[model samples]
Target: MAKKVVPEAERRRRRPTRTGTVLSEGIIVDTALRMLREHGSGGLTARRLGAALGADPSTLYRYFAGMDDLTRAIGDELMGRALAGWRPTGDWRTDLRSLGLAVHASYLAHPQAAVLTASRVTGRPREIAVDETILGILRGAGLSDPAAVHAYHAFIDQSLAFAALDAGSLALTDEARAVDEEMWQSTYALLPAETHPHIAATAHLLARRMPHSAYPAVLEMLLDHVATRIGGGGGGEETPHG
Candidate 1:
């Protein structure tokens, strides 16, 4: 319940807190991300944020409409980090793969924050830039407008979906995580061969692979399909090794 609510546009004159640290959107989002990492999403409270910023809790509305607004901005901050200093190499498949990996890596680095943000639609600067850049990459590769849009949808959603999934696992407690990792080898591997022949057959492989992310391999398969669509096997036929 912020008092004297000031919308984003009206908060032009930055005021220093009692600690003399000026409050800006960047600082607020950075602090929020730290809080999200330290205390989880449920721990982000106005009183806590106010203490972190050395400012009054009611002053938050001067920059954002509410906590939800701040959350979106924090999500976009991850997006910004994902593409920070990223430049396209003009090769669509190569660039797309790099972008996908970059996004995945950023989320992995901030697992707790990623869990809260991976499914959000920020519509902020970084989110828009990443989408626009992906679209540009597809179109530059000669994908027709409709095809580019379709591919862009699949590409972005796939990245975020896997990010959310993997990040959720990463956010778990260490003991909990180890339990899940072991279950594939322990439970799945030990299934009787008579009734579960398929599992028994591939159980060893599953044990070796299930603990790792499926993102990189699945990304390659998707790119291979995209290459086929690019005609004459031009895009990623060789699967460019980094």
Candidate 2:
């Protein structure tokens, strides 16, 4: 199916606001992200968005079908950032690691927004391209069709799942987030040795490392599985150098 291009060009020609602010998809999305950051997801209403954009709520509908559509576009923008300047290195493991880190970083960069949209299937250009790229990399690595597809599924899903989990923690209110951090240090690290010997033994290490993201570790594990399945330490063959 042919995908509809976001009407960015058309949106650029949209009428100027009462405050003389030019309205475009970029401006709207930027404003929306800022609003999301400042006010949390619940505060990103169409009415509020319009006020921030210096236009009526209905005016936004001219560009976005509605809030859901606008949200997907915002999500796509994050995907676009992840893919930006990313070129496969033809070494599948290295490339996938780079790509996975890019994705993980992109979501962490916008924790609030990521919490809202990390699991979404936007069907936008960047999202579609990313899926194709991951699948292509798996196939290019010499996996059979089923193996490549299955690996692709595990890789993408795991990446997003970790992103969402990490982002959710980061998105919590400061007090709540601090509680989580405290729990790692004060609670987990203080478990009784006789009751939970393993956790007690690793308490100090867990307190220190638990605050960090596990996405990289998880990504490497997934890649290791893929490598084993493909009959190589990494991909069976290097991706063709461009």
Q: Number of the top candidate by lDDT?
A: 1
Lowest lDDT sum, 10 consecutive residues, model 1, at 233-242
Cα-based RMSD of the predictions, in order? 5.0, 5.3
* lDDT of candidate 2 over 1-242, digit per residue (tens): 32344465565545679779988777888899999888989999999998987888877876887788888988888888899958788999999999988888888788889988888989889888888899889888888776787787788888888888998998888899888888988788878999999999998988888888888888889888888877863333334430
Cand. 1 TM to true fold: 0.90
TM-score of every model versus the real structure = 0.90, 0.88
Task: Please give the lDDT score at residue 175 for candidate 1.
Answer: 100
For 157-205, candidate 1 gives per-residue lDDT tens digits of 8898899889999989999999999999879999999999999999999
Show model 2 residue runs off by greater than 4 Å. 1-14, 232-242
Model 2 TM-score (2 dp): 0.88
